[model samples]
Target: MFTYERKVTYSEVASDAMADVAQIVRYFQDCSTMQSESLGMGIDFLAQHSHVWMLTAWQIQVMRRPRYFEEIVTGTWAYGFDSIYGYRNFLLKSSRGEILAVANSIWILANTKTGKPERLTGEMVQGYGSEEKYPMVYAPRRIALPKTWEDLEPFEVRRSDLDTNNHVNNARYIDMALEYADPGVNIYQLRVEYKKAARYKDKIWPRIHRENNKLTVALCDKDQKVYVAVEIATDEN
Candidate 1:
């Protein structure tokens, strides 16, 4: 596993002075990206080969949110790869060595030109070695939609929401879904399934459903087809 240490900045924290869930997700994302970059299979390399790694799903569990200015360590490592799909795990820990969060993610190597999944090359497998999967109850990549949904106001995608790939950044979907979540609820688990990429100026029709301590938000298009499905579980669950 590759690890890096840093202090949480004010920008990464919520009003409560604790790191926001989205920021926690960002930490995990960065750890994986840094690992890929170090392995000579980063963004530049993928772009040069007309390939890109598309994040298909994320399952993260937050044990505790570190406070502002708190030093923490973030790490990630590949656990497996199958066909065109890759599996990775991430961890965030406090300076005291307490695990703050852990995550499992799925990614697909795709041909940017044709938008089709590409098989992993031999060099790709050797570059980044695999490890045992993180010890956590793994959830399915696909989240089941509720029978009914409460439609909310539509949101137009902004330039800021676009990532280097010109698609809505994975973390941005979490930020958008949280807008419909209960502010008082302490989210302990988050799962996001990215169905399709949303480009700038696309209108997102959000719908929410609440059952007990679990809240789900589906960001969709006008036709009601989902772009991203976010499932949040509070401690009460």
Candidate 2:
């Protein structure tokens, strides 16, 4: 089947300075669409495929926020297939093909009732979309991770961290934004943009700088490519 693709919108951007992690997650939530497609792709093998696609984990990185009606391409294709699970990679890019974000996920097919995965069947394996280019690459859109985090500090997000998606699972920006913390100070305020999706297991480092109650934070790859810019508010109490 053809890979799913589309542009992005303003609503998809994270704007509130006091926004919660779950709010930041809406930017990448296509649950209904992705769910339908995922199961649909299971084809006749879904029930008998032996293996199931469970959301074992994910590594996601977003570079910058997409403007309303921004011409972006969202693509999802198989990254790799194992006997027990299938690894997939996703990308969001500018119309010009500039990659804005990259994400990888592992899924397993298992008995829904028993929660046990079975080996992938030939048909189950064949039905998946084509293998993604650079299947092993962790982050294709990002340049090298940040060389170093010169300054680090403490921070926090509160009830605001809870969003419509319910929990911060809408994405993991809250955790990403907090990465820069030294555990020396308590976080009082946080504001971050949703440049990309922070899927399960995506390791994000928060680079921090502070002036009294004002804090600046940026989310980056392991190498530390600053992707999301953050603003913080603190009372120092």
Candidate 3:
């Protein structure tokens, strides 16, 4: 497992002075990236080898959102790898060691040039040894979409939304989906399934469904084919 400590900044918090769910996910993402960089398998190394790790799904559960300026620790570890797929887990904790959030993620190793999945070799994962999966009720990688939803105003993907892969960042999809969520609802769990990469200038037609405390958003193209699907569970029903 790899861990890092940092204080929540104003920019990472919501109006309620608590860290936003998207920011929590960012901390987890950054921790994993930092671990890869330390293991000599960072972004530069992957790019040089024409390889990229594509995030296929995420399951995050928030116990409590840390307040602004609160110091916290974020940790992550690779739990397993099979063929071209990798399974990892993440945790966010307060300074006192209370778990704020935990996450399980799935990634696919793919050839950047050919867009083909690459099988994991011994050398490829030698540095990052597998560890036990986090203690959480793991959600499936696939999120079931509702048959009906209300369409919202579509928006174009901006350059700022792109990460090093030149497509929408994984966490950005959560940020977009939250725009259609109830402001009063405090999300307890979040799950995302990325179907396709939304590139710069691609218009995303958001379709939302609300059932009690749960909210689902499907970010899609004009044809309704999804780019990403997000499901949110709040505290209240």
Best by TM-score: 1
Report the C-alpha lDDT of model 1 over 1-237, residue by residue, as the tens digit: 999999999989988998888999989888888888988889999999999999999999999999999999999988999999999999999999999999999999999999999999989988888999998999999999999999999989999999999999999999999888877578899999999999999999999999998999999999999999999998635
Candidate 3 per-residue C-alpha lDDT over 171-222 given as tens digits, one digit per residue, 9 for 90 to 100:
9999999888878678989999999999999999999998888999999999
Report the error of model 3 at residue 38, Å: 0.6
Please provide TM-scores, in order, for all candidate models, with all chains considered together. 0.98, 0.49, 0.98
Point out where model 2 deviates above 4 Å. Answer: 4-7, 16-39, 42-52, 132-237
Q: How accurate locally is residue 124 in candidate 1, as Cα lDDT from 0 to 100?
A: 90
How far does residue 68 in candidate 3 sit from its true spot (Å)?
0.5
Q: Write model 2 residue lDDT over 140-189, tens digit each, in one string.
A: 22222233345443233344544432323334554555544444343443
The lDDT, on a scale of 0 to 1, for candidate 1 is 0.93
lDDT of each: 0.93, 0.49, 0.92
Pairwise lDDT winner, candidates 2 and 3: 3
Model 1 spans > 4 angstroms off: none
Best candidate according to lDDT: 1
Candidate 3: list runs displaced more than 4 Å.
235-237
Residue pairs of candidate 1 with colliding backbone atoms: none
